[model samples]
Target: MIKPSSPTPDHLRELKFSCLDQFIGPFHYTNLIFFYQADAAAADDDENGYKSQALKQSLSEILTVFYPLAGQVVLEGNSSINCNDNGVAFVEAKVLDGRQLSDMIEEPNLEELKHFLPTQHFVVEDNIVLLLQVSFFDCGGIAVGFSFLHKVGDGKSMGEFMTAWANANKYKCNKCKCRCDDQFMNNFNLASLFPPVEFLRTTSLPSTTNLSEKFVTKRLILDRKKLTDLKEAIVSAPGSQLKDPTRVEAASAFIWKHYIIDSAAQKRRQIKLQPNVDQVEVVVENAFMAQHTVDARTRMNPPETNVFGNCFLIAATEIVNYNDQQQEMHHLAYLLRKAIKKIDGDYIKQVQIEGERYFTNLFQRLDPVLKGKLGLCSFSSWCRLPFYEVDYGWGKPLWVCTTPIPLKNLVVFISTPSGDGIEAWINMLEDDMKIIRIE
Candidate 1:
């Protein structure tokens, strides 16, 4: 356990989670893995030990600032945490077999990749808000992984926390102590904007934890040329809403099209198997939905980025019945773009005006999917997130990866080191994996 280097101030002793945070639940964790390859020859155990010590010491310093991470959540109310400097979980692992980072990550299996991260299951009582692990490879490559409780924050908060950790390492001095300026600080003003409430407790969020079907997470990488081609193809579609298509839009649409095609295939097979049904190939045109979490920070500047909690709202695409092959991926991309566009300044105000009711209404929209009345898929993009900016004197990571996500029908987009390529990890049923593999 890595406690704060010092005790938290009395004034900042209690920190409340936002309504959105409560709704997100502590059952889930936001996981990230950063792999770094040294420029010179592989460092020995002594050298790696020194590096780990540096990281541990720096982590202690940052906990004093990002104190919520070191605190315990009250499971009863599920509202606030006691900032008592209880500390975080930190682990260091060495590959038992003589394996290098490059070999391990070359063709990453999501389940195998998860081993590098911490906290596969959350122990509710402990309320250890954050857990970090440092995995050492035989060839000096290091993988820094973390498991952050979802209720504490979202992707934006996790990104900023990483930045804070990196800064703490960069700004620290062994000789003397110095107070960092406001630029290095973060605000917890979200509680004021979206205060803690018991009303939202009844509202249910989508979960796949109890799923009967075996789920698998697969990563699909689109290189620069492939991504560019996809964008061009999407833009070239006649009557497409897209003037210029983004990687997320193009990729989302591409996956959506496949899903629709697969749905049609599934329908045809069912029809053939049914006793009374006509044995004919059925081309099913189903209404599907797309959901994405849009960070409010993306629409803000400066200080806004530093204000964290669950600072994001869901962007749900319009009900889509995609049967037209000529429309291609453009239609779905347009729908996604439209949904995301609604998350503007006006929408932010609506969230304020409607308060927590807005979130309730937004989640209620997914009732159809929750009831199995609508086809659904969720997308979360970390392409331009601060995961790329993490530098602790040794320099930025060589690669950034996510752990196994149990949520079925979810696509997580991470950016390649080049920033031009996209690595999309899709979590779906084991049977669906065959369909995905073919595509």
Candidate 2:
């Protein structure tokens, strides 16, 4: 049994405030996908009762254990959603059949799901949806999937909380010993940094028109051999001086270029809204090559390392310009590479200091033609994530997927699969998906 720490005194309130602020975001979204196998005997034994009772019981215990940490989850910056005034809104449901789960999981319908979720304008109250889907296989095992919002917390923080909750549930049933320490929760305060406010505005406001477009999710598996060959080609190129860029970096660049070229091509094919508007503007932005290192104070150099929560800031490689003529795929790819390289650690730090200034200047000198019609902008490739480490004693998941969540325009992610190479999942408009190039 893990020992409990002394109760945190009221004087040390800043710690709690900092913890809450750290998790909240002005412009951030995150989701969690959980896969589980049901126990057949348990289902058969509880024929009269709901088979999912055990799972619900487990979830209840986990939430109780995390009650203290719940306050830490809050909103930062400017957000239309009022999380403080409205408590955590979680939705729970099960997938009756595997086919149903497969259909929704295959190509994510982001716009449809967004509509179903509680929005600020739709209702007087605000809430977050926690979608739970359960499928029973012929073999008697059950699979559970969780789709969570990132506004609450990042993947790392979500995993830690889930682990603690699972461990607590296991201890209740005497299946395993509880090793969770109260010190983890005692050191932080939950209600200081961002006091409940009436209204908050987003840095970039949403479009006035309703999003009528449909969305689709597709997967592209790049095996080890093929990935190796692609990397070799990139490295062997005469001018390519990045001695060794990882497969993730190279693939991200390749995919990004394909999309940009296709976007530009689609623009050329479109009919002008007006005769004066001859040039089309395309903007491609992504969080590639953005690395956030741990602070010195937080790192345990010699003995231990605290790898809990997401201790990183988000940065993006953005491209904004007007094109009167179509550009070649290769040229677009090269420009993306150059833009990504320009924001190294030093550049990022400088941007961090003067980022607001730069944006302010740009907005002040905004172009008349490019005032409102900006196409889909995105960020992808969530590499080096610790998702697999979230083992709730049932071993790692066979496959984990996150989809149907909307960003400003779109957001794509690629992560290592338990069995092989990488799995690519995108949350985009149906029209945007048509132009996406995997090659």
Identify the candidate with maximal TM-score: 1
The residue-by-residue lDDT of candidate 1 on 48-141, one tens digit each, is 8888898899999878778888988766666677888989999998866877777766766667877887766633436778999998887778
**What CA RMSD would you report for each candidate?**
3.2, 7.2
Over the stretch 1-439, how does candidate 2's per-residue lDDT look in tens digits? 1111233234431222222233333333354455544444544434413545444555554443344332223244432222121123333343343433334445545343332232323211223323344444433444444544444444555556666655654455342456555524442222221222222223432232233556466656677776677667667765655556566655555565556567666665563444454342323221112121222112222211233333333333344443432223233334445555554555534433554443444333323213445343445455455565545455555456554544333444546554346665555566777886664
Each model's TM-score, in the order given? Answer: 0.91, 0.64
Q: What is the Cα root-mean-square deviation between model 2 and the actual structure?
A: 7.2
TM value for model 2: 0.64
- Model 2: weakest 10-residue lDDT segment is 285-294
